[model samples]
Target: MADYADITYAVAERIATVTLNRPEARNGYTIRMADELGDAMDRADRDEEVRVVVLTGAGRDFSVGADLSQGGFDFDPESGPDAAWQEPAGRCSKRIFTMHKPVIAALRGAAVGGGITITLSCDYRLAAEDARFGFVFTRRGIYPEGASAWFLPRLVGMGTALDWMISGRLVDAAEALSAGLVHRLYPADTVLEEAYALAREIIATTAPVSVAVTRQLLYRMASAPSPFPVHELDSRLIGGLGKSSDAVEGVVSFLQKRPPEFTMRVDRDLPDYLPWLHDSI
Candidate 1:
């Protein structure tokens, strides 16, 4: 795995753990850190041995937001750069969206500002009972990045999203669960363990091809309008992948009551539509 002061990655038991390593700053993310995370997540997605990826942060929080004090903060909020701040952050989010494997956010403690947005991007989210989440962009005299402006309202509703964004209130785990912000809330110490256990259960069942196709379809439907072209793309992907050796092995393993060895890898480059320009839209 690529090494960075901000992040660490390791694969074990068909699972990849991507940990935000900067605890002293409360795991605050910078452009460079997000870029590294995007690379790490891409590596995990391409590795066939990795069936699941889990994201977590060290110290008392998942993330605090941008690290302004950290020198070389490449993403400028005031002056426009080549890409929006959402570009690097969305790279990590879109990887989780399109990856053929499962990605879970094992959130503990505070998930504030961009941190909450990152959690929204994951396939599954589980938070500690004591975890806190907030959308503080309005308070910061800025708009939401990391696609939160688009995603939050969908996950919750327009009203809740507006209230959170406008009020800049910190939401607790129970409120977040009620608002559809997270799937489950466990004890603080057990959040990571529970997330891993859930991943294991999913790994034990389901075909890799099926999961990938379903993920693609869901992301398309949620993010884009449906049309003949979209359906055609879906049909082609599903049909092409269904005939692969890995797909066959998946079925055969089910019949034989054994574990499947998924052999497919991401041989294609991600499209330009990805890492989408947030403000451009």
Candidate 2:
């Protein structure tokens, strides 16, 4: 519902779509865009009516990375005090990681550097047939930003992540899919449609709070040394949910062989343990 210069935000049918709106520079990423994206994501996460979010670009490209219109000086971190510096793309990616709503990236064209890194936190990436991707930091004589060193390896495995990040090569849609960078490939025009369809499907069938908790657990437990921690967290979440109104409806609907009308609001109904509260840096 808020206005953004570099992106558009809309919510319909419980889905909030955050679109990168800078098309002129192949939808180049910018500091303003990243701030806007993080703000939009926070809005979506707090809105109980929103169950899913779809991230995409407004024009031909998703993003070719940060706008360097001013010159390469923008990449000079030493020019600014380290404490005052914030990687714009990293802020957005962190927001995605923390959001309760599932986030899906819909890529149509070039997604390189900040473009690709920004999407690493998305639950899934659906790209178009003509999409081109890269992690070109090495080629630019810079290291990866946006905490991509952590996200990239997790999503695509260390070997593949190293190859992609170290090589700094441009990859086509096929290679992206083969390398697990994206989950599905579709025609450019249909990528958004598919993303919307997927969102609707999830909204219709799943309990919102359950989905939120499950997403958190999966992401948090990935680096867990053993299943014991997960088991403990799972027990607390599941045990609490079993007594919920939504759970009752879920069971009743199943017995009656009908669709469930889930009523749990994420803001009001999410378990206390599921939240990972923190102070801002």
RMSD of 2: 2.0
lDDT of 2 by residue, 1-281 (tens): 35789899999998999999988778888878888999999999998989899999988999999787734334555666366667788999988998889999999989999999999999989999999999999999988998899998888799998888899999999988988889999999999999999999998889998788788787878888999988887888777865799899999999999989998888887777653644252
List the candidates' TM-scores in order. 0.83, 0.94
RMSD in Å for model 1:
4.2
Best by lDDT: 2
Mark the 10 consecutive residues where model 2 has the least summed lDDT.
272-281
- Clashing residue pairs in candidate 1, if any? none
lDDT of 1 by residue, 81-192 (tens): 6544445556566666656677899999999987778767788889999999989888889777777877789889999999999999899999999999999999999999
Alpha-carbon error at 203 in model 1, in Å? 1.6
Global CA lDDT of candidate 1, please?
0.78
lDDT (Cα, 0-100) at 29 in candidate 1: 77
Instruction: Please report, in order, the local distance difference test score of every candidate based on alpha carbons.
Output: 0.78, 0.88
